[model samples]
Target: MRDRIDEEITFRKLEVLLAFMETGNLSKAAEALNVSTVSVHRALHSLEQGVRCALFRHEGRNLKSTEAAQMLADVAQEVLTTMSDGIRATREAAGYSSDRLKIGSLYSLTIRAVPGIVIDIKVRRPTLQVELALGSNAELLDKLKRGAIDAALMALPDADPEIESIPLFEDDIFFAAPAGSPYANQEAVDLCDCRDETFVSLGEGFVTYRGFLEAFRVAGFTPNVTMRVGDIFSLMNLVSGGVGYTLLPGRVRGVFGDQVQFIPLKPQFLMRQTIGVSFLRARERDPNLLALMAVCRLRTRSVI
Candidate 1:
C-alpha cells in the first residue's frame, strides 16, 4: 500500500503541479520548472491520471486548477516543509554539521576582539566546531551573500535591508608612535607636526584608513602614507620599528603594549566603527546562530 501511494504521489510530479497551480499557465509552469511546455502538460496529465482526477481546466491562457489541484496545494506545501526538516535533521544526526562560520573583521579586531570571542565560545560549546575566515568588509559581505559564510563581524556595511546587525562594541582611533618619538612625549600631538613624517597605514577600504583620511582633512593636509599593509600587526611592526607613525584603533595598544605609544590628537578627534554581528535576517531564528549570538553578547558584556 505504501509503495502504491509513493508511486502515485512523488516529489517530481508534485513540483510540476505546484508550479502550475502558482502560475496558472502551462507555459509559465514549464518556464519555472525549466522544462518544455509539452513536458509540463504531460506531467500534469500524468499527475491527474495517478490521482484519478482532473487537476486543471482551461481558462483563456490559463490552466486553472480543478477542485483537486486547489485541494493539493496545502498538502504539497506541507510535504515540502517536511522534506526540508527531514534533510536538516538527517544532516545534523550524521555529524555533518558545517564548520563554515566565515567571520570577517577589520585588522584591529582580528587580533584583539576575534580571538577572545572565539575562545570563549569554544569553551562554552566544545561540540560546535567553527572555522574562521577573514577578509575586508566589502569582500566579507560578498562572501556572506554568496553563502560562503554563516555570519560576519563587520563594520557598518552598506545599506542592506536583508541583513540583521547587532553592534558589539565601539572603538576610537588613536595616534601612536615609537615611545621616544618627539610626538609621543606630547600630551596631545597636533596632526601638523606629523606632516613631514612617513606614516604606516592600513590599506584603503579599512575603517581605520577612512578615519585617518577624515582626521587628515581636519588637519588640512594629505598626510603621506609611506607603507600600506592589509593587517594591523604588520602595520604595528612598522610603527615599532620606527618606520613611521600611524593612526590605529585603541585596541591595538593592548597587543603592542610598550613597543608603541598611543597619543591623543590635539583636537581629540573621535571616530569609531561599531563592530557588530551581521547575518541574513531571513536566517535569524537558526539554533546554532542563536547560540553564537548569545556567546557574542556575553563576551561583549564581559569586555564592557
Candidate 2:
C-alpha cells in the first residue's frame, strides 16, 4: 500500500490539495492555482485515489478537508519547505547564484591586499555578494581546483595545470623584529647574522615557510626555530614581545604598525614572494572572476 501511494502521489497533486484546503471551493482553488475548475476537481480526486482514502467531503457546492487530508497537508508543507531549502543550498554550493562571489586568500594579505580588492569590486558591482576564505597557499589552491572558491589571492606559481594565475606583484621577504632590536637599525641584514638567533616562524605549508627555508639555505645555516605559529599576525606579536625574529613580506608592516620593524635582506640573501590571483583555467570567462581579476590588477598596479 505504501509503495502504491509513493508511486502515485506527486507534488502537483499536493499543491492542488493545499489550494483546495485554503479556498474550500473548487472554482476558487483553481483560480488561485491558475488552473481550470475541472483540473482542480480531477487533481483532488486523483490524490484521494492514490492514497486510497477519503480526503474530502462535500457540503452543497463546497468541499471541506477531512482529518486525513489535513494531516497530509501538514506533511506536504514540511516536504515543500525542506525541498526549497535543499535547492537553495545546492545552488550556493554549485556557485550558480548570480550575486555571489567566493574568494580565497592568505591571512597575511587580509591586512591590505584583500580589503583593497573587495572595496574596488563592491564599487563596480554593488549587488555582488563576496565571501572570503583565508588559508595557506596550498589550501587556497586546492579550493580553487575543486571549485569551492571562485578565485584566490596567493603566491605564484601554482603547479596545478588547471590553475591559471595572473601575477599581481613581487613582495620582498624581510627580516622582522621588535623596533628596539639591534637588527632593526641595519641598512640590510644578512640571513647568517640571525642563524644563531632563536627564530619565530610560520608553520610548515605556509608559502612564507618555503621562502624561509630558501633564505636559510643561502645563508648556509638552519634556524634554531623557537616557535611555529599559524598566522603572520601572531608570529609578529611574538617577535614584538622579544620572543624571536621572523621573516615576512613587506606588507606586514601595515598590521604590526610601530611595534615591529622590517629590514631588507642583503643582496646575496634577498628572496621575494610573488603574489597573484589564481583561478581554474576553465572559469576564465566567468564574469565574476573576471571582475575580481580586474580589481586585483587595478589595485596592485600602482603598489607593485
Candidate 3:
C-alpha cells in the first residue's frame, strides 16, 4: 500500500495541490510555481485521479477545495515544513548551515569590490565563515544555480528566471592602451579610430568580451584580430606591452598602475557594466544570504 501510494502520488503533485489550496486560484498557483495554468490543472487532476477521490469541485470556471482536499493540504504543509527543518538541521550538523556562506564571483572583482564586501560581512558576523570562489560570470551563475554557492557577484543583466539580483553599482568600460600609444594621450578615443589596431580580449564567455564585441558593433567596425586570452591581467599585460588595445572596466584601472592608460569611449559608444549580487530566489530567506545582502547594500551605497 505504501509503495502503491508513492507510485501514484508525487511530491510535486502535493506541492501543486497545496499551492492551489493556499491561493484558491489555479492561475495564481501557476504563477507561484513558475508554470503554466494548464500544467497546474493537469497536476491537480492527475493527483485527484491517483487518490481515487474528488479533491476539488467546479463552480463555473473556479475550483473550490473539498473537505478531503483541505485535510490533505494541511498534512502536506506539515510534511513540507518538517522536511525543510530536517534538511536545515542536517546541514547544521555537517557545518554547512547559515554560519558558513559560499560566495562565487567574477575574477575581475577579486582585486577590489569582492575583498571589501567580504571584509564588511566579516565585521558584522565575526563567527561566520565565508568561502570565496572566483570564476567567469557563467561559471559563477552555474555554481549559484547548483547551490554550490550562496550568492554570486557578477555583471548584469542576467536573464535566468530562477535567479534574483540586487544591482550594487555600475562600472564604466574604458579603452585600454599602452602608455606610449598615441591614443593614450586623448581625453576620449573613438573606437573607429582604432579599427585597424590589433585587439587583445578575454575570450568569449567573459562578460567583458561581450561588452567589447558590443562596443565594436556600436562603433560600426570590427576590431582587427590579434589575441584572445583567458584572464584580464594577461590581456592587460599584453596591452601594456603594446601588443594591442583592449576594452575593460574602469574598476580594473588600479591593477596595472600607470603601465596602461584607460580612456573613456566616445559618448555614443559609451558602455557601463552593472555589477551586482545574484542568488537563487528559493534561498532568499536563508539567514546568511539575508545578512550578506544587507552588507552588500550598505557597502555598495558607501562606495558608489
Candidate 4:
C-alpha cells in the first residue's frame, strides 16, 4: 500500500502550514498567502490527514498547533529552502544564467542594435550584469540551443518548437564595394553586372553569406570568391581595403560609410534579413528573459 504521506502530502500544503504557523490564525495566513481562509483550513486539514497525526487542536474559533506540527514545519522550511537553492544551481549548470544574462548576437548588430538594447536593459535592471557574445547568426543560434547563451539576436530562422522568436526589424542586403570602385556610382547595382567581379564573403555559417550566394545564384552564376572570413567585420574590412566586393546588410553602413559604398540591390536580387531575438521557449516566463523581452518589444514598437 502507498504511504499516506507520500500519496497526499504536497509542498503547497506545507506552505500553507508554515504560513499559519507564522501568522497564528487561518484568516491571517490566508491574507498573507493571498488565498481564502477556507483554503488554508483545508490545506492544514489535508496535511494532518496525510501525516496520519493530530497536528493541531481546536481552541474555540482558533487552532492550536501540537509539537508534531512544529517539527514538520521546521523540516518543511529546510526542504523548501534547500530546494530553491538546488533549483537555481541546476538552472545555472544547464546554462540558464541566473547571476548574469549572457546574450549572443551577430557581430553586425554590435555596431548599433546590440549596444542600444544593452544600454536600455541595463537601465531597466541596474544591478543585473549583461554580457554580449558576438558571432555569426548560426553560431549565436547554436549557443542558444546548447544553453551557452540565454538568448540570441540574429536573422530569425524557420520555426522550432523549442525556440520562441521575436522579430525586431528587417535589414536590407546591399551590394558592398570599395568607395572609389566603378560600381559605387550606380543608382542600383545589379548582381548580373558583377558576375565578372571578384568577391570576398563570410564563411558558410553566416546569414549574409547565404544571401550572397542566393543573390548571385539568381543572377545565373556563382561568385568568384577570393577569400572567405569568419566574421562580418573582417569581411567589411576586406571590401574597404579593395580586396574584393561583397554583399552586406545595411546595418553595417554606419561604420563603413566613408570607406565603402552600400548600393541597393536590383529588385530581383534584393533580400531583407529579418533580425530578431530568440530564446528557449521553456524560459519564456523567467524574470530575466521577461525583462529582455520587454526591451526588445520596446524597440519593435519604436521602429514600427
Q: Candidate 2 regions off by >4 Å?
A: 1-97
Task: For candidate 1, report its TM-score.
Answer: 0.66
For model 1, the superposed segments whose C-alpha errors exceed 4 Å read: 1-100
Q: Write the per-residue lDDT of candidate 2 for residues 91-192, one digit (tens) a residue.
A: 655544468899999998987788889989999899999999988888888788788888989998547778889999888888888989988789999887
Writing each residue's lDDT as its tens digit, candidate 4 over 1-304 gives: 9744566689889999999999899899999999999999999999888988999999998799999999999999999999889998887765455669999989888887888898988998888899889888888888988888999999997789989999999989999888789987888998888778899999988999998888888999988999999998899899999999999998888686689889888899889999999999988877788899999999898752
Instruction: At residue 63, give the lDDT of candidate 1.
Output: 69
Candidate 2 versus truth, CA RMSD in Å, comes to 5.2
Model 2 residue 60 lDDT score: 81
184-258: candidate 1 lDDT, tens digit per residue: 678887887677888888887676778889998888899888889887788889999999889987777767788
The predicted structure with the larger lDDT, 1 or 3, is: 3
The order by descending TM-score is 4, 2, 3, 1
Off-target runs (Cα >4 Å) in candidate 3 are: 1-96
Better of 1 and 2 by lDDT: 2
Question: Which scores greater on TM-score, model 1 or model 2?
Answer: 2
The number of residue pairs in model 3 that clash at the backbone is 0
TM-score each candidate.
0.66, 0.70, 0.69, 0.72
| Count of residue pairs whose backbone atoms collide, per candidate | 0, 0, 0, 0
